[model samples]
Target: MNETKEMRLAAINNLIKFISERGRRFFYRERNRMTGEPQTAYLKLKNNRIYFVDAYTSKEVYAYSGYPHDGFSHGGTLWALVCDFSIFVRTGKSSNGKHGYGGLYSGDWGHGDEIQEEIINYAKEIGYLE
Candidate 1:
């Protein structure tokens, strides 16, 4: 199955709605600061933009920032991910053949249930319907 523009928009809208409805009041994560432990508030999305309420204590982190490659490479990385998933049933990796999410996926970070489910549901709803 392939995703249409409408399907992609729907998925994006669903993700936004899910986050808006059940994101968090004040989510926190452990951080390191000099000698004492610090608690960093989770990032927030407002009007489709990300913000940090507790900016001084928070750090920007990407789970796959250094996975198989540096994510910052300017080769349309996210578009490639979307294209491979939207068009093909597999990434040609025999070890994990036919799993919807393909080669470039990193394991989920332990943020909790809501975001994880939101990701999976959006994927399926957008035509990765495995």
Candidate 2:
């Protein structure tokens, strides 16, 4: 079924709201600098933004400097992801269907079938599917 762009965007945003409201956290794979042992932490989100102080430790593994990817956040790259999902629902095609994300995506930034899967699955889980 096809849906409007605005509708899809709203659904996506709602899913994010659901997560943030629950105070849910995610972890990134990181190795302890001092002990050389890998560990995970509950990455914190404050006021709709991720803060370093929110994490259990100051050190974060697999940190990104500028933008976030097509993952579960709403930032630089997520804007594109939202647009792509909207287009897919409306047009039934996402950037030629070659790549999961829309337009010219690169692995360096936001590009992966995993993100697409996350979006679809989460949307369905949250009753965002249309």
Model 1, span 36-106: residue lDDT tens: 45443322334543322331234432212222223222123332333343233222112222233443333
lDDT of 2 by residue, 1-130 (tens): 3665544445544554443333221222234444555433323333433322112233422222334332323344434443443344344344322224433233433325666455445656544443
lDDT of each: 0.36, 0.38
State every prediction's TM-score relative to the real structure: 0.28, 0.28
Judge candidate 1 at residue 34 and give its lDDT.
29
Best by lDDT: 2
Residue 49 accuracy (lDDT) in model 2 = 33
Steric clashes per prediction: 0, 0
Q: Report the Cα lDDT for residue 95, model 2.
A: 31
